[model samples]
Target chain A: MSDLVNVSYLAVGPEILLTLGAVLVLMIDVFRQPSARVHAWIVAATILAATVVTWFQWDRVTGEGPFLAFSDMVVIDEYGVIASFILLLVGALGLAVAWGMVERLGRRGAEGIVLVFMAIAGFQFMAVSANLVMMFMGLEIASISLYVLAGITRERPEADEAALKYFLLGSFASAVFIYGVALAFAGTGGVSVYDIGAFLRGSVLLKPGVLLIGMALLITGLAFKLSAAPFHVWAPDTYQGSPAGIVGFMAAGAKVGAFAGLGRIVITAFPLYEAEWAVGLAILATISIATGTLLAIAQSDIRRLLAYSGVAHAGFILTGLTAGEAGMPAVWFYLAVYTVQLIGAFAVVAAVAGPTAAGSPMSDYEGLSRRSPFLAAVLALFMLAMSGVPLTAGFVGKFGAFAVAWRADFEWLVIVALVASVAGFFFYLRVIVLMYMREPAVAEAPGTMRARLEPVGALRWVLIISTAITLAFGIYPTPLLDLLSTALPF
Target chain B: MTELVLFFIFGALALVGGLTVVAARNPVHSAMGLMLTLFSLAVFYVVQAAHFVAAVQVIVYAGAVMTLFLFVIMLIGVDKAENLSETIRLQRPLVVLVGLTVVVVGVFVAVGGRFAWITGVVGAGPEVNGTAEAIGDDLFTTWLLPFEATSLLLIIASAGALALAFFRPRRREGKEEGAP
Candidate 1:
């Protein structure tokens, strides 16, 4: 009873580093109001340091079983480490993509940077935590930050409404989730994933009603975060209402964390009940893909369109999950590529629409090719990638996910997904055609030009890196696949 | 026997309080009913010998959270009774069906022996289970990560609240004009 547990802070190195950076930014904002550029540098340095730390952990940390630390609340594993590295990249690119907005907001923008750091830290925790309560806390930390980020621009009534709706719905989801956690704890007599898994493995209950209900509730809550159907009502509104500069970050970061957490729970803790969960997940995937793609066609707002598309993408990721533990690498690869493309697409949005404004009509993008050829071309590339065009990362990702689902005997779901993807091509290509082929529709105003494009600085770097990666991975996916094959979250 | 009687009384009060919360016309009345439910729940904890939980429940839920709710209700000026209109089509009937299903399921679970596994494993433990020291030990050991993570969550909440609600950025101040 008196035995001391060996605690290692190194297990949470990335999280600790990012937290310190968040604190430092907040303090700097208070004491000596730094410019957004200075804060960007700080954020960049912190992300680089965190990445280095993750790389070090990748090499240093190895064992037959997961090296659990902090009284067995967290594990230092390659799966989490690789995910952390990808999350850091997402954070870095997200910062670059939103730099214009930061500069626009000037002194107040430091909080956005801090919030981003906090969100990344929370997401890192979500990936690494082994305890249910700890995961919930991480979810809350990330979510609260997102709710505020959604309403960062209070001047816009839409932003206010988006924030309020998100808060209300998100809090409801959290309540449902915590209730499920309590049930799981009561049923299994444990809150840690390891303990719960051991308990379930040790016995066979004829009527495991509580655990089943817990799993269902848990899936519902995470589905809401992932923006799956029936639980995705708030997504389009929130995405359209939030500042254009950071919506991609918010969406991508949340998805990464949710997928990691979901993979952890489904693969590691609840494998015994695969038959039960896979059916539910398949249903969710079908509805999400069908509803998301069908509704995306009717949307004129680019942000809302992207929101629906994100829902469809969520369905594709869930297809990967249907393969159980065997599907984790595919999910990881898909998330890594998709999130980069998501941020890049939104960077273009931020450039076209002012960083903080809402109400960007699709018509605004007409003749985007002539006005700013670089932005138009890159945006088209991202759109093509998202549509799963050949020789793009999205194609490989969708193929991997669909193949895994097929191998898992979700043949009907694969057929549905294929049809949805083909239907998805129309809207994605519409953006491309509108940008290149159509002439810029002249505005009614006398002196005003039809469109105004901002001078993109750091965003260009984000676009270049994302586009390069998307094309590189599409043409030769073996390297990334090889790397991801080893990073399985066993 | 006295403890059992006290338990029944508090449990009855809690159920009635919950019904009042749903049935009350005025929002303020509903809030009052919520306080009653919370207070009764604290009493239930007390009966279970979870003195710390009982105290915290009273302090946090009945005292602070209830006060905050009342203040928000007063501020929003929604304390007046609503018309109880059915806005969405089929919403009332759907809610009724769902509510009935939930009630039926709850009754079945409570009466069924599905939860026997819990009691069989835990046994009828002694009063030491709910003591402050026992909770403290667990919090410092097994639950330490969640406890500390809570601070980070609070920080995010505060920072987000401030950033969203208060921080006002001057628009295009001290910048060159007509650049783009």
Candidate 2:
């Protein structure tokens, strides 16, 4: 309960910037009749500004004593900065891909952009949160906005269904997470991660029963968010049913936030009991990988296929967690690379289908190469990256995750992941095959059903940038690895 | 002796209220049972010297949150009868097994020294614990960031509600705007 308030202001500059940006966008949307493009530019500028603020915090974050603010409810650290930076990048890319959605929604598009900023701010808060209650608040903020965003196309019944399902399941998960925090508080008489860690370390309990249950519950709630199997039933439906434009942001931002929070909980709070939680996490990871790979093979819709792919990727990320403190950098790297590829793939999906549309069947992508070579090539590239092909970001990500897990003595889990990686090629390659090998269908009416690419200038930029990053990281990942090496949770 | 008697009476009331919630046929009756359970829980909190929590339980949970639940139920057509039959064949047996296991585990832990630590006060027992003044001081100082963040969370929620529920989508032109 320090008396200094100004330090807290400096610590939370990025979040403040995002919150003000969100408010400003909403205000402008209400007062001014600006084009959707204007709103997009404003959103992009806000994200860039937040990024700059995050950059300035880097020096302060990595400084001696690792600056904390608001009675240690928030911390400025390399871990939070890197995670927040990725989340903001994801937001910017998601907004770019959502350009068609903005134009399509017209006046109502500002609401979408506002929700995006709110979601990003929420996730950024999760990354920096020092207190358990603050973490829960951040999770709720992000998840609530995502649920509403999932149902943004109110005209579509599928969107309504997606929003309702996500809201119901997501609220239940949040309650479980908060209940775990309450139990942890009761067990240790502490709420902040630092306090809890000190308490756990100082105590020698004959029975550490309640705390273990709390940790298990905490992991379960985050596992649900990560879309790990056994709690992954909501993902495919939500991803397939929600509007195509913002699904990438929803999926990627949630992973970055949840992983950041979960990593903090496990590494910061539960290191003493690593043997117990790592075994449990390993089992969950194996299940998610196996289930995601096997089920993705049978998917008809491309969105559902990607949903399962996301599930497998979640398993890959959790493998990094099994390495305890040592695996964090790999976790960050994998999330950064995979999320960009995910958003890029979805950007292509939005380009082929209208942004607001939900379902995009596999047949819709047939002969995409002839229709638009650029879009088809980008989709294929992302698919190759997603499949962990050599000389792609996904390959390096998979290698880093597996290498860390193996070093942590989770060899059997690594073996399972290796098998799953081979299985992943089937579905990802199927999309590529549909795009390249198949022929475009003839229209019944003169030329009504012809394959014509949308004039999505923003999506093209997103594709180009994501593709370049994917390739660059794949070839020379030393810089990203170096940057992530310093991102240690305090 | 009087304290023990009060505990028994309130405890029995809470158990009955919980049973009523599960046994009631009507949704409104179930809601009433839930309120009874909540009120008895508030009494428990008060007995533990958590007066602030007790007041918040009554005001926020029983008063405001329950009202919202009832409003949603009414708005969504509470007149519609719900199916009481089990959808899954093994649901009843599974519920019974889980309930028995929970009760057994609860009794086991309660008989042990686990619950003893819960109320083991080092210095003060009841006077300063969970008082409004103590909570308010902590909220304003120790939890200042979370408090402000909570205000921002509320803003996001209200905005989400406005976007999702209030704003109506405009109809498009003749072009159905199918797959691009």
Against the native chain B, each candidate's TM-score is: 0.78, 0.74
lDDT of each: 0.85, 0.86
Question: In model 2, which runs have C-alpha deviations exceeding 4 angstroms?
Answer: A1-6, A63-65, A442-447, B1-23, B75-77, B83-127, B167-180
Tally clashing residue pairs in candidate 1: 0
Candidate 2 structure quality by residue, lDDT tens digits, B1-180: 865787888889888889998998877777888898899989988887789999999999999989988888778886788899998899999999989997887677667644433311235544657889989887888778778887677767767777776655444532355522
TM-scores for all candidates: the values are 0.93, 0.92
Instruction: Report clash pairs, candidate 2.
Output: none
Off by more than 4 A, model 1: A1-5, A62-65, A443-455, B1-12, B76-87, B101-122, B125-128, B167-180
Cα shift from native, residue A218, model 2 (Å): 0.6
- DockQ (C-alpha based) per candidate is 0.38, 0.39
